[model samples]
Structure formats: structure tokens, C-alpha cells
Target: MQIRDLPYPDPGVPDARSGPRFLLWLGRNQLGGQLRSLAWGLLHFGSIAGLPYMVGVAVEAVLDRSGGRLALAGALIVLLGIAIALGDTMLHRTAVTNWITAAARVQQLLARKTAALGSALTRRVAAGEVVAVSTGDVEKIGWFVEALSRFAAAALTVVLVCVGLLVYQPALGVIVALGIPVLALAVLPLLPRATRRADHQREKAGRATELASDTVAGLRVLRGIGGEELFLDRYRTASQEVRTAAVRSARMWAVISAIQVLMPGLLLIAVVWQGVHLAREGRVTVGELVTVYSAIMILNYPLRHFEEIAMAYSFSRPSAKRAARVLSLQRTAESTVSRSRDGSERGEAMAPVMAQPPADDSLPPTGDLYDPATGLLAPAGRLTAVVCGDPDEAGRLAERLGGHPAFDDAVDMPSVRLGDIPLDDLPLAIARTAVLVQDKDPVLLSGTLRELLDVPASGAVNPEEALDAAQCSDVLDALTQASAGDDPMTAHLTERGRSLSGGQRQRLALARSLVTDPEALVLDEPTSAVDSHTEARIADGIRHLREGRTTVVLTSSPLLLDRAERVVFLADGEVAAVGAHRELVHTEPRYRAVVTRETDAERVVDRDTDFLTELDIEETA
Candidate 1:
């Protein structure tokens, strides 16, 4: 079957029994290819078994002093050698096909699961665990699945050889049959302990990989805070732990390997010793003794497979368990549609109109946005500014307004009910269309200047107008300078917009969000990266551009606040007082203290200085 045709199993509820069962299922599903591979394996192993029998015939012919029969025996040996070489080539070709196909299937499943989980995956499973499952675990699973058929064929070949020995020379045959199992099964008891060690090693390796990934992602911040060396030391310590775990895992396998070699050697010696005794008693001819020895020597191939199968199991079981854990994470509950206000078509129309006022109850209250959580309502459809004394309270209020699930518990207790409307129930495509959040450090993907400004879903505004509204004309000029006008608007950006300065990247991200022009826009410190002059221009432009739109800006910048129609002072994360910028400056002492950074005496002095400076500048002009 094609990879695309394989059914995608639900990752959130992976069947615990399915990992091992999948091998049987795959064999059944791809029975034709499996049968072809098995046929080749049998043919290859059969040819090998026939060689020892042919050698015995050649030795017997030499002992009989029969020249014609001796010549025929030599010809038979030559033909058998050619057959073994041909079979071995075909065997390898088919086995590799089986291995590749199995690995491909596992990879396809992993890709589907990643797509299904989306953003929720990172919140639930460790990034390193997912990486390990996709890379190392998939290959190990394929190795075990492919080994099953080869193991079956090897086992059959050994049985055939033992049966032939029993018929040709009974006493020596019994010893051969009994000794093979003892060597093969001896490694079985050590397998459980070996597997446990391997599992522990894999877990430690995954944790180290996660730490490395996190460190790289945050390296810039770590360095800025002078903690880079400290983090590096911690990572080095984690690396050493992984190394120690790996050594412990390797030691266990080493013991298994020693046993695999030593047991086979001892078995070989026992068979040789018994064959010598039987020959002296005249119970077996010299040629028969040679055949028994040859079969015993050939038993190594099957015995070696026993060790390999044990190893495959030890690796695959824990890997499957890890994969299962990732698939078991639950998705959030979907939203439910409420009944219309009336039973008429007008009611149907009115229901949507009313719902628009609160399209997503799951969304937390922004600065002026009403949240039913704390019984505080920032009146809808008006510009509202929040002034919070505690930065932590402001951040928490912002998170609640954003409808983060972690803040759901704080809903509907004089605060807004963000969970009344099921977030999952709202069509993601529709919910995102209404509410757009512009974070402080919005991620910028590598692309041309024009492409970077294109919003994810809708493209309503003209690109140039959006850029102008965001006061990013200078940013556009910089792009042209860098690109030399060959393709200024289409110049490629580096990953994460690394080629652009921090403020430039921030402006571009803002322009991209503005282009979307959602019904409600919540911006958290959008102008924090820009200079004071640019910040003032952006604040004035935003007020003009978003005249009729519901826009919420979270910032401590007085420049941005001066443009707001209403400002709400938040003390300890709740509404302490609310008014226009000038009104709050007079009424709320804490608000005046925060925004003006002054005591009453300093405020009067600063006010006089501001009045005199304005009058002097006017006279000079």
C-alpha cells in the first residue's frame, strides 16, 4: 500500500496493544510482499542447508574409490555453491525493501500525529520525546518488525538441518538438536534487565536533548543576563549524566554479547566431542560424522538471530510506550451553540447580532474589554486604557483577557467568564477572525517585505496603506537600501527576521497584524521597542487608523496613553479607578504617581516647567 493510503491512528488515544499488533497487521495487510520476501528467505536458507549434505556426498564418493560418482559429487558441490550465492543476493534485496517500507509507515504515522496535535502538542509532550520518537524510535521499531520474518526462516532452516541429521546419523543428531536450543534460549533471561537499562538511557538522552533545545532558543536572553556560562555548566552536567546512563546500558549488552559468543563455542565443542566417540564405536561413518559437524556449525546462523531478536525487542518496547504517551493527550472540549432568543427567523438573525457582542466568551478581558470573571466589565466598543500599579497584576489581567486556559478558574467571580463559551467549540477559523492579539515580541517568519506583512487568514487591507498606518515607511526604505531595488519588496528575510533590527522586526509584525484588521485587537506593549519620536507617531496613527474598531493597547508609555479616550487605573489587577488621562491625573493619587513619576510638590514644579517650555518654544517659532 502507498504511504498515503495508510489510516492515521488517533494519537490522543493510541491503542496500548497496537504496537506489537501492528507487526501482525502489517504482515496481513501487505501479505503479497511479505510472502515474496519470505519465499526468498526460505530459498536462501535452503541452499545453505543443502551445501553440507552435498559435501558429505563428496566425502563418501572419495572414500568409496568410485571416480564417476566422485566427479558427479564435485559437480553437485559446484552447483550448490552457485545456488547459495544467487539466493543470498535475492534474500538481501527483498529484506531491505521490507525494512524501508516498515520505516516509512512509522514515519507517516508520526507526521500525521504531529499535524493532529498542533500547538497543544508542545504543551503536553516534551519536545525531546517527540524528536526521539520520530528519529530513533521509528527506526528501531522498523528493525524489530523486519527481523520477525528473517527469524522465522532461520528457525526453519535449523530445524530442517537437524531433521536431516537425525535420519542420517541418530546419535549425533540428538546432540545437535538438544544443544541448539540451550544456546539460543540462554540469553532470554538477561533480556528483561537489559531492556530496563536501555529504557532508562533513552529517557535521560531525551531530557538532555530538551535542555539543549531550550538553551539554544533562549541563548540571547541568557547571555544578556550574564547567565550563559551558568546554563552551559548545567547543560554540561546533564550531558555527563546521559553519558553515564549510556555506559550502563552498553555494559548490560556487553554481558549479553559475551554469553552469545561463549555459549555457541561451548555447544560446538560438545557436538565435536560426541561425534568423535560415536565414530570410534563405529555407530557412524566418517562421512556421516562430517555431515553432523557441518550441520552443527551451520546452527550458528539461527542462534545469532535469537540474540538479534532479543535486542530488537529490548529497544522497541519502551519506544512504543513513549509513542503511546504522546498519542494519549486529550484535546480541549468544543463550544456549544445556544438556542435563539425567539422561534422566528428574526430571532435567528438577532441571535448572531447579540452573539457578536461577545462572540468568544472564552477570550479574557483586555484593558477596556469586559470580563465576567471578576465582575468587572470594560464597556464594549470604546477605547479604554488600564493603569496598573503592579506589573504582575497587569500581566495576569492581560492573560485573562487573552482567554488562556490557565486563567479559567478566575472567571465569573466578579471577573469575566472566559469559559462560558467553549473555546474548542468555536470554529478556530472564525474565532481568530474576530480577536487578534499582538504580543510584545511577535515572531517574524523569513520572507520578502510584502510577504511578511500578509496576515495568516484574511487579506483585507492594502499592503502600502497598512504599512503607512503603522508608521513603517522608514522600514520600507531600509529594505530597499538593503536589496538595491533588484527586488526590494520581495527581498528574502533571514529566519526569525534576524537580518532586521529588533524595532524593525516589531514594526513589521505590527503591520502584519494591522492588515488582518480584526473586530477586536489586543496589543500588549506594541511600541516598546521603537524610539520616543517613532512611538508618538505610531500612537497618533493607531488612534486615527482604529477610530471605529475595538482596539486595546497594554502599555505603561504615557505617549500612547495620551491618545486614549478613557484610561482605567488598575491597582492590584482590579479596576481601582477609571477616567480620561487628564481626569485620572487629578483624581487618583497612585495613578498620578505612576504616570507622572512625581510627588505632589514635584508634580506642581514639573507642570510649571512644561508650561514655560511650551510657551518659550511657541515664542521662538
Candidate 2:
């Protein structure tokens, strides 16, 4: 079947509920497959029950001195064997089908939830947790769901077998019937402990996965700072912790398995001993005793399923909880009112539309992008630079401008309006379209240079133009250097852009954002990776390419600020000062200090007054 046609079972129900109730919800949705599986299981088990009776008849006929009846009984036994074989094959086929379908359903649900959460997912849930839920949790959940029908059919077979035994011989039948409940109920106490251990193991696994993801994402940075070995050691430690948890979980399951096997063996021994006594007393015939013994032996299949159901439930419950948590993440809020022909909200008539206005008018006029929380306004159409001494405040401002949920009023945060518009009222699509924030480490998806530059909402800007704008001409040359005669335009990028250098990947990401040509582009130190020459070129190219568009550059780089129409120095996340680059250099001491550090010559000169004096004396001579 096609992947798109796969079923998606919801994992979120109520928290205060039993596992069976949750299972019932899944079963009800997939009744046809479950019923078919159930039918096959019953048929197979019924045939198994018939075997003991056929054997008992053969024994009776051989002992009775009736040759014709013995032949007839032998023939019936052969027919029953054929029936058992046919039923067993069909049972296996149906059960496996149920398992595959259940696995598909869980996978579909996970994929759907991931899509719904979008970028918010990574912010809310750890990347490792998400990876664990999709790969490991889906399988465990499917195992439990598929096991339910088989368990039900096995239970029914046990009941029918017990009833048949009672009709054949009441005294021995009662003993076999009494043992069924004991075998099933014995493992219930062990379930809670097993489940707890499984939960712990799953949690540890997720943490380990998250640690690995973080380490891999920042591998370049770690290596640059000579901390690759340190991070690798940390990951190894985390992996060992996961291994320990897994072993602890395995130990609990081992105990439960021993009990399942040992209890059934003891039950078989008891039934056999009781049957011999009955035969000695001459109260039961030999054939009837054999039938009772055979039925008790057959009880093993159903009892084994009881153990499996317990194990499946123990593993699946936590997985379901994790899937539910992902699904429950809310999307960004939008207005209920429809948009007008002019792209304005139909319900409200507050602001007049301007001529040749910015692509998205949801952002206020006068170019004043305000965040009420910190009382900051980034005036429109001007090159506004945010200089935060605190890195976290800069991050917060960048998130707000990008309309991330943490700063967005609609997503469990305080109602801090942006300009006069309620941040939530503005359409999420429009808000995102208006402002594009490029993080320091933006993701570079696997694609050719041409494909990377053609990002979301980007018009047909020539690949050459975008590459030049982001100062990626050298990066393109570097790709050719790495591989002889490799087509820069058609070269295939590996997953997560692993094939490229860190600086190359970063520049490509910047080019992609520039290609989008958004009304307001928010770049957070977009040139932190590239050389000084490339950085200056990018700064110049950005000013030229986005001459009319509102661009906000978050950097302490004086080379970039030198081209800005206005620079807003951010102190403790507030707009400390707003003016031209040269003006900030002369007026703000903090700005001067920050910009002075950008030049290595100034740092060396500041360190040595003798060097400065020698330069002045040589000029005078």
C-alpha cells in the first residue's frame, strides 16, 4: 500500500485512564482487521483443542478390541491434524498483517503530529525525544495494539476448552479450569514494576539521543574550540547510562519470564499428578485422563499470550504518552475574520493602505516594530542594528521579530502588542512572511547551490545575484577546489549539508534568506563565519540588494554597521541608543568599545604605547 493511504491512530486520550480503554479506542477504529485476526486465532486454537480429543478416541478404540473403530479414530486424528495445520498457517498470516497495519498507523500519527508542530516542535520537545518517539515508540505501540486481538481469541479458546473438559470428565476438568485463572493473574503484580523500569529506560534513551543530536549539530563548533573529545566523552557517558537503564529493564522482564515459564510447568505437573490419582482410584477412564492432561498442556499458548500482553502494555503506554505530548502542541493563532481584496482584515478598519506598501501590511506603518515587553521600537525602512551586550536578550528580540510562540501573545505568553496590532491577531503566515530572522546557525538543507538559494517565498532572483549578495562566490570556488570539475550549480548536498564547510554552509544559508527578499530581513551575525573581506562584501551587497527593504542586522561588527542607515544599540534588551554608525561610534562609549575590539590593530596598539610612539617618530623624521 502507498504511504499516504496509511491509517493514523490518535495517541492522545485522557491521562486518567486504563491501558485497555486506550487499546479499545484503537481497536474500534480498526475493527475489520482486528475481527479477521480474532477469527483466525479462534479457528487455530479450536483446532488445537480438537487434537487432545482425537488422541483420546484413538487410545480408547485401541484398548476396546474394536479394529474398525480404531481405524476410524486414526483417520479422524489425521483429518484433525490437517485442520490444525491449515488453521495455524492462516492464524500466522492474519496476525502478522495486523501487526504491519498497526505499525503503519502509529507511524502516520507521528508524521502528522511532526508536521503540525512545525518549527515549534524543536523549541518545545528535545530533538532526541522526538527521534526516540518516532523510531522506538512507534514499534512498541504497534506491538501492543496488534497483540490485543490474539490475546482475546486465546482467552476465548481457553474458555471453550475448559467447558469441553467439564463435559468429558467433571473432577479433572475442575482442576484444569481452576489453574487457568491462577496462571493469568500471577503476572499482574510484576507488570507495574516492569512498566516503571521500561519508562525509565525509554527516558534515558531519549536523553542519550538528544545528547547525540546536540553534539553532532555543534560538532564543528566543538572541534574549533578543541572540545570534540570532551563532547564525545559526554556522549559516551550518556550512552552508558542508557545501557545501564536497558539492563535494569531487561532484569525486570527476565524475572517476569521466569515466572511465566515456571508457573506453567508447575501447573502441568499438578494436573498430571492429579490425573494419575484419578486413574488409580478407577474413578476416571484412561482416555478421559489423557484428554485432561492434553488440555492442560494446551493451556500454555494462552498463558504465554497473557505474559506478552502485560509486556506489550508496559512498553506501549509511555510511548503513547510521548506521542500524545507531541500531538497536543498548539499551532500559532490566526484571526477568525477573512481577508479583504486589498489584503486587509475584513472585521477591522483601523489603518489605511499605503501606495506600493510593504508586501505584508500586518506590520505597522512608520516602520516602528515595537515589542511592548521591553518597550523597544525598530523604526521601519531604516537599517536598524540591535547591539545587545547580553546574548540572551538579543535572542529574545530575534524570536519576537520572527513571531516565535514564546514571544507571540497567542501562545501562553503575556499579550504584548507589536506596534498597535495584537501579535496573535496578525495572520501567522503574513507575520512570518513580513519578517525573516536568520539565526546564527541556520539549517542548510541538502540541495544544489541553485536549490539552496531558491528558499521559501523567494522570487526569481538569478542564482548569480543571490550568491554575490551573500559573498558566496569564493565558497562556490571552494566546492570546485574540493572536487575536480564538480558542477557548482548541480552538485548534490548531503543530509544537513554535511558535505560542505561550516562557513560555506553559513553563507549559503544567508544567500537563501537574501533570495527570499522579504520586506524586513533580520540577520543575527550572518557573517560571523566568513573572512573579513567576504564579510565586507556581504555588508556592501546587502545594502545594495536590499536598498528599499527594511533590514535589521544583529551584530557587533563595525564593518557591517558602517553601511547601516541607523544603528540601535541594545542594552539589557532595550533600545539604548538609535543613530547612524559614525554617530554611535562617537557618542556611545559602549558602542565605541565594541567597535574598537573589532579591529586587531587597535587591540595591539592599545596594548603597546611604545609602538604608537615609534610610528609617530618615524613619520616626523
Candidate 3:
């Protein structure tokens, strides 16, 4: 297919058994493109190889003093030059097509895998590693894939040239044939060293990328702790180490390059020296001597291709392996069983959940959400606030509520059910629709506010209403003002909403979740970044808006807890107390202590604000 026709209709399923295997799979799928590239490559290199022979004939024609013979050689030379020009141009185009298509296919596969794995992909692989794989690694992989066909053509040209010499001049043929193997195979022993260094450099680079990402993400925290300079110094050290590793890796490759040139030059010297002796003895003619000498020089061109293919493979192998490992990740522990070989019954997991048809859009088992492990039940069509002391446990429980594995390797874990129907037994689409879990750090993808809020929502809550409930009027104003003439809905956000404050990003994310308007929504510390007043407003909005939906909140906020219809205080991973927030505050000391500490924290903030206000008022006077 042409470059415009890409990114392939289907990238095709990959073989993730090993890195080399993955590379093979990519090439095998693009056989048609590879063949086209190979044809062009052969035509180009064939012209280069044919040039020396034509020059030899021209020399012979001059020595013989024959005008017809000289004119014929000139005509052939012109034809070969034309072939060189056209072949080289087309070769470049086909090679580029292969490169872009390969990269596009890998990107699509990575995207598909990432979507399938969801948040678990990052839990298993570092965010930096993923970024590296999707960006830099993809380029390296494409480089090798595009090099394969050219290398094939170059190697073939070398073979045919050696054979032509054997037929035309047997003595020189022996020398060229013997030297060709040495030139090609001489770098084999050093390649292992080169590959190791490349791998080490890549590893160091990945770590450095991860460090930079972390430093940027927490730059504000570093400044708050008076450690920004310290972190900066650490990143500098990491950066220097990466540079050092890259330089070391480059030095090795340079040595290999030197070998490629030096060995070929030495072979040319030997061939020319021998050719002169043969001419002196009258055993070979002057035209043959020139042919042998110029042929060695032409051989140098293909030799560079050999080194390039080696270098490309050395780099792309590791990249392909990293890509393979990510693609191998499964969304669920038992996904292999749920999906059929032909994908005929890909949604087989939902068979148990959808045993009978339903009249409404909602799936069957439309009742309370019950986590078997913690004995936590969120009653249907009500707001339930869960107070957990440990944030990690709260996060794990929230993930479990949506039928997702809390830990990276969690398997055969207790299942959460929608009443009698197991949530994990349903297809991802149904499960996601049934229970929408919004973690505290919800990402604001780069797009206009309208696009960000445009999701597969239930159509119950409009973006305006959700934004109002999320208390994002200031956010809209900020976006609109920053975007100049653009409306808030059309105002584009930068990646991760970097332009917005933490409170604004959180409010916008909350607005997006509210827009989805799922039957059951689980929010983890949704109001943590917002002020107490805004949090109170959000609490009121949620209560008024979600009048008949299942809303589960995992937070220790007193205001949110007070507004909840029923509060479940979890201790030691199980429900320790369940009642109205007022009843729990009055009766349960464990529950009351948690809420009291949060309330005290809010009061401290109030006192600090008041002190600042008083100092400002005095300064104004």
C-alpha cells in the first residue's frame, strides 16, 4: 500500500514470543513492500556493479583503436547511469514507505495494547519505558525493517560481482571471492560487544527518561520541600551518565565503522597490487587491471550497507523485544480463556452476566455492588461514603469496585458482584458502563474542553451541568481567557492540562466523569485538590444531581461524609462501622478520630488564611 493508505487497515496480531520473533513478524506481514524495495535496490546496486565492467570494455576499445566498440561502451555507460538515477530515486521512495508503515503499525499495536491493559500497563511498566517504546524505539524498529531489503540487494550484488570476476578473470576472481567473505564476516566477533554496549546505553537512557519524567511531575513538591536544586542536581548526574553511556556506545560503533573501511581498503590494495603484477607479466591486460581495481572500489559502497544492516539490527532487536513484552500483557488474568482463537466469541466473558435479555440499556444484575473480599456493599440508587485510613487500601478497593485487578500480578482474587452477577464475568464494555471508577489523579487528555467531555456517556448529565456540579466556572474562564477568541468549549488544553492548576484539572476531570453519568460511580478523593468551600459545593451538587444513582466515594472528608446517605468506615480492609456520618462520629471512636483529624486539618488551613488576610489588611492601612 502507498504511504497515504496507511496506517494499515489492520496491523495484524503480533507474535510476542521473543524480540527477534516480533521483528520477523513485522517483516513477514510487509512482504509485498519489502519485495518492491528489494527490486528497486537490486536495480540501483546492479547499475553500480555493472559500471566497472563497462569502463573495462571502454579501455579495451581505446587500446584496439575501434570507433564502433568505443561508441557501444559509451552507450552502455549512459544506459547504466540512467538506471542508477531512476533506481536510486524509486529505491528511496519504497524504503521510506516501508519505514513509515512499520512505525505506524507498531504505534497502533502499542496503542491497542495500552487500551486493553488500561492502568495496569503502567503498574507493570514504567511510564518512561512506555514513552520510549512508543516513540524512540518505534523509529529504531522501522529503521531495521526498511534496511532488510537494501541489505538483501547489496549482498546479492556482491555475490554476482564475485562470480562475474571468476568467469572473466579467474586469478583475480579468487582474490575478490576470498576477500568478500572476510570483509563481510570480520565484524562478527566484535558485534556481541557492540550489542551489549547498545543495550546498556538504552537501559541507562530509559532510567534517565524516567527520572526526568518524575522530576517534572513532582517539580512543585520539590520546591515546596526546598529540594528543587537537589533534585535538579540529581537529574544532572543522571543526564551526564546517559551522555557518558551514549559516548561509550558510539566509540564502539565507530571502531566497527573503522574496521569496515580499513579492511575493505586493505583488500583493494592487495587486489590492485596483484593486478599490476599480472599486467607486468602480460598474463592480464590493462583493461582487466582497471576493471579489478575499480570493482574493489565499487564493492566499498555495498560494504557500508552491510555495516548499516548490522547497526540497524543491533538497535532494533532490543526495541522490538520491549514492544513485544508490552503487547503480551493481558487485561485480565483469565483473558486467554475468555477469548476464542478466531475471536468468534471475544465477549464470551459476558455470557454469564447476560444470560437473559434486558429491556433497558443497563446490563443484568442491576442491584448493589458487593465486594466479596471486604464485604463492602454499595446499595443501589444511593450515595455511600467509605472512610478508609490507608490511602493504598482505599485505592485498591476502588479499583476492585470496577472489576479491575488492584495489583499488577493480582490473579484469582475475590470478585466484586453486581448483586448476584459477577462484575468480572462481564465484558469490559458492560462493566465499565455499569461502574465508572474515577481515581483522584484523573488525567485531562490534551483536547478542547468539548472533546474531553465528549465520551460514551449515558446522556443524563450535560457538560454544562457536570461542569457546574464539578465547580469549574473559574476553570472555564481561565481556559477561555488563555485561548483568546476561543470559547471555553473550544479552548484547547495542553497535554495533562499542564496550563491549569491542580484544583482546576481535578474539577475538569470530575466534570468529565459526571458527564459520563454511569449507573454506579466510584470516586477516590475527588475533592482532595479543591478548597473546602468548593468541596462542599461539589458535595451538594453530587447529592442533588445523582438522586437515583449508585455513588460510592472513598474519602475521609467530613463534609462529603456528612452529605452521604450512609457511611461505611473500613478498618483492616473490612467494614468496621456502617451508619449515618453523624451517628458514626458520635458513637464509633475509630471512625470519629479519622473524621475529627480531617476537620482539624481544615481548621488549621482556615487559621492560616485568616492570619494572611489580617497581615495583608495591616499592610494596606
Instruction: Judge candidate 2 against the unseen true structure and give its global Cα lDDT, from 0 to 1.
Output: 0.73
TM-scores of the candidates are 0.73, 0.80, 0.88
lDDT of 1 by residue, 1-621 (tens): 433544434312235355565555545545665676677777778777877777787788899988888888788878877877877787776666666676676676667666544434675687877888888887887777667667777888878877887787888788777877787788889898998898888888888888888888898889899999998998899899989988998999899989988887887788789878888888888788787778777777766777787888788877776765665443332233222221222111211111333545454322234543322334446555666787655555554454432223322223223223323345454445556667666888888877776666445566776688788877777778888885567877789988788888888887787888766666777887899999888888777767776677777788888888767676654556666788777777788888877788987787898899999999999
Residue pairs whose backbone atoms clash in candidate 2: 367-380
Candidate 1 Cα misplacement greater than 4 A, ranges:
2-13, 16-40, 61-120, 155-169, 333-353, 356-421, 426-441, 447-456, 483-486, 515-525, 539-621
Residue range with the least summed lDDT across 10 consecutive positions in model 1? 345-354
lDDT of 3 at 361: 42
Best by TM-score: 3
Task: After the best TM-score superposition of candidate 1, give how far the Cα of residue 580 lies from its true spot, in angstroms.
Answer: 6.6
Each prediction's RMSD to truth: 8.2, 7.3, 9.0
- Count clashes in each candidate, considering only residues at least 3 apart in sequence or on different chains: 20, 1, 0
The reply for model 2, stretches above 4 Å from the true place, is: 1-4, 7-28, 64-124, 221-237, 331-370, 375-383, 407-435, 547-550, 589-621
Q: After superposition, how far is residue 331 of candidate 3 from its true place, in Å?
A: 1.7
For residues 1-621, what per-residue lDDT tens digits would candidate 2 score against the true structure?
222445543533433244445455666766887888789888778788888887788788878977888888788878877877887787777766666776676666667656544455787788989998788887887788778888988989989988988888988888777877887888789889889999998888888899998998787789889999998899899899989999999999999889888887888898789888889999888888787788788778777888888888889899877866775565555434322222211232224222343455653323445554444455556676777767766766676666664413343343223345554555666666667789877887776666776666647456678788887877788766655656777666777778777788888888888888776788998888888888898899888887777788888888898887777676654556667789887677676767665465765565477677889999999
lDDT of 3 by residue, 1-621 (tens): 788897778889999989999999999989999999999999999999999999999999999998899999999999999999999999999999999999999999999888766676788899999999999999999999999999999999999999999998998889999999999999999899999889988988888888888888898788899998888888899889889988988999999999999998999889888888888899999999888888889999988999999999999999999999998876666532211112111222221232333455455446777775666778778999999867688888888887776554256456677856777677777888888999879998998999999999989899999999999999989988999966799999999999999999998999899999887899999999989999999999998888899899999999999999989888877667778999988777678768877476765686698799999999999
Top candidate on lDDT is 3
User: Cα deviation of 121 in candidate 2 (Å)?
Assistant: 3.8
